[model samples]
Target: MGVYSEGFLEAVDAALADFEVEIRQLGAAASDAQILAAIERVVLALNSVSQGVAGGVIDTDEREQLCLFIDEVMTENGIEVGELAARHGVSRYAITDRWRRW
Candidate 1:
């Protein structure tokens, strides 16, 4: 049984795709403040996804994919998984377990 429908995952993917484009556009020419703002957006997005998973709005497979996405985003932004886990009130082990599967 799945907690999230296929339509939900597709919507998430579409939103992520838009985010990626926005990040790219905030490239070298973007100011330090702009970069920080962009990072904040990513953080908010990850937090939203984490909250959804924690609240049982996302299924196991969706959680796995979201975790992978979170890992990638953290790596790219030089953020620590432990830091994110702490912020989200989730166990680092849980995050890492899904991240490893990615």
Candidate 2:
């Protein structure tokens, strides 16, 4: 068992799936604009999930999994997280920190 419920995990998976779709929809020549938009949406979705789960409060374990999830999704879509963070002047682990209220 994990720190999150099955429903919570499902929501996270759906968010990631939608993110992949959004990126692929822009085709192989995905604009940086497209990438950034999709990133924002997914991060928002994760934030919503957290809110729905427990008043937007993410525990330590849930936060770890959520961060890992974003990193993997970005890498899978050929989005270099290092460069993404560099552009925002944040750490790679902080990629999802912008919209992550929890």
Candidate 3:
């Protein structure tokens, strides 16, 4: 009954975990640029984690998952959006703007 296979979901989860690890390693003093770059990498990885997932097919649930993942990462890493934007001129909400396919 799932839109995606369990294996594909697991891979996506792993990709998120990898991004979380990167954020944890970056710690409290990480520059916005650094965090944004990591976000870009994970967005790309998520966009490509499974075949037949491209061409503007990001479903509602998938989008929610992505947003939650990104927000949770920022929260867990103590990333303040206004501060990060001031630091690097990049909005935290815009992390997927430059990298996500859908």
Tens digits of per-residue lDDT for model 1, 29-90: 55545544554565455445545543235446765665566456544654465665666576
Candidate that scores best on TM-score:
3
Off by over 4 Å in 1: 1-8, 53-102
Residue-by-residue lDDT tens digits, candidate 2, 46-84: 888878864235667777877787677667767777886
Q: Rank the candidates by lDDT, best first.
A: 2, 3, 1
The residue ranges of model 3 lying beyond 4 angstroms of the native Cα positions read 50-57, 86-91
C-alpha lDDT of candidate 1 relative to the true structure: 0.53
Error of 1 at 73 (Å): 8.5
Clashing pairs in 3: none
Question: What value does the lDDT take at residue 65 in candidate 3?
Answer: 72
User: lDDT scores for all predictions?
Assistant: 0.53, 0.74, 0.73
Q: Give candidate 2 regions above 4 Å deviation.
A: 1-3, 53-57
Q: Against the correct fold, how does model 2 do in TM-score?
A: 0.74
How does residue 28 of candidate 3 score in lDDT? Answer: 74
